[model samples]
Target: MRRDQSPFLLANPRRVHAAPWETREPDQAVTVVGDFDTALTEVELHGRWDPHLKASAAHVLRTCLVGQPAGIIADLHDLADPGGESAPLWCAAHTWGAHTPSLVPVVVCLPTAAPLAALITCRAARWNLPVYASLPEARAALRSRAPRTDRLTLHLAPDIDALPLVTQTIGEACAAWHMLTLHRTACAVLTELVANAIEHAGTRIDVAVTRRPSGLHLAVQDHDPRLPHLAGAVPGDPGDSERHGYGLRLVHTSVTAWGALPTRTGKIVWAVLTAKSAGERNRRRPSTIPGTTAPRRS
Candidate 1:
């Protein structure tokens, strides 16, 4: 870590967080602060924990609730766990519940199997905390919460040029969080998707962007009538000669929430960067492009 870097920043890559915490050190980095008006009291995720980055997110949550009894209202309604690895979730939830009596954790997960439910059953049984299936139900119980705000969506061509286009578009609109790493990540993802669309899906691509109260939304469309799956940022098929195959890995790694949506043509791959990350992504685009040998631009 640099003398100027925060100790809490990711020192090594953890399997938990995909690639958002990919780099050993980004040119610009921010300690994610959950904002209640201002990140005064909020959950801040640090480092990488695979399927979910919430592993260390309890830090800000605990800090925010210190001395103050008013707890936070967390929404885990849309959370997806593919690996069946619940350690991180259990760690984040159970540990937080134990530490903060003032900070109430609203468990908002979708209905799960009896086995899966068993994992979180302890939370409800012990804390008497309400576990809701949707955000609406959870919102009704919380005392301090705001109604969901409007969503801003952007749809565009999946042209190779789309990277610069979308980068500039998102950079300008979401100027509040101007982290260049976000743009770089977006640019990298766009490059891969558009390339895949052109090569495998028969070009004819589409992309959309939306800014919801919770985060910024991005959707890319194509006409090949095919579906894409999450793959390692580094391709396991070493024999593969595909160019930029690892793009989606970073896309998956960078945002808070992301996935693919079925479309009439192919599919729309989307991702969301939380509003909390605005300040982080907007910090500054790195002068030197990652992995390049050239010096940074002045």
Candidate 2:
């Protein structure tokens, strides 16, 4: 019989039997195995639990989640903590949740009916983290969620001249996704965002666009931690057309939704443009009309 040649079946094949890359210390070990099929970074932890254990796990997890994979499979079946404390485990979960661009879905595997399992379950409820008894089960959970594809990441200097190039890059993605109708609206939102980053922060900015089933999600990362909110400015008159404050206001009016989050290094401002019927954008009203308030960061 011919073996399956599907990449899904063969992802990261060379590393199938490879020893997991490990981070070791006197009291603990955290090993990570890449399972590319599900875009999961499989991590296994073993040893005593302590405040330091949490910090060590955070450090290791930062490395594992570098590319912002779809999800994480954390195996704690070998963990040797007898005290049944879940704080150290939750620390890693918190770090994974706090990641910018997007939070990583974490599926934790622990022994069935183990003391630690109960402890983790109790706290997991508060954070909505998933706990499973086996690796296969954890994989199933990740598989059930909708997949998001990373379309592109572009780094540009803080220059207004880059605006056209940025819009062109966005146009390409919109065309490929069959969302050509959104091109105009997307360009407007992106131009406003990029211009704001360059003017206020004056640092190199990174822009990432991801395609989702519902829409295209755009994120602009800057060195400034300060978040931007939609200004009260409205382009109801000629004077407002040239105002600097209209940038975010245009963002609020054009995109379906927008928000901001702080990263370890800086901050990421994100917006989503809902897929719309051809020419539907022309009929949409400004987001600040009448009783409506400007979009606020969630």
Top model number, lDDT: 2
After superposition, the stretches of candidate 2 with alpha carbons farther than 4 Å from their true spots are: 1-150, 233-244, 277-280, 285-298
lDDT of 1 by residue, 163-253 (tens): 4555555555455544343554444444455555655665655554444434454555665544555443345755452333444444444
lDDT tens digits by residue: candidate 2, 1-298? 1122111110110111111222345647665554323445676777766666655566555544433546777788888766677545555565664563456776778886778777767776676667789999888888788365756778989887777777778878887888876767777777777878888888889887777555676777788766665345446776654564666656655665565544555566666677652135456653332211112211
- Candidate 1 versus the native: TM-score? 0.38
lDDT of 1: 0.41
**Candidate models: Cα lDDT each:** 0.41, 0.61
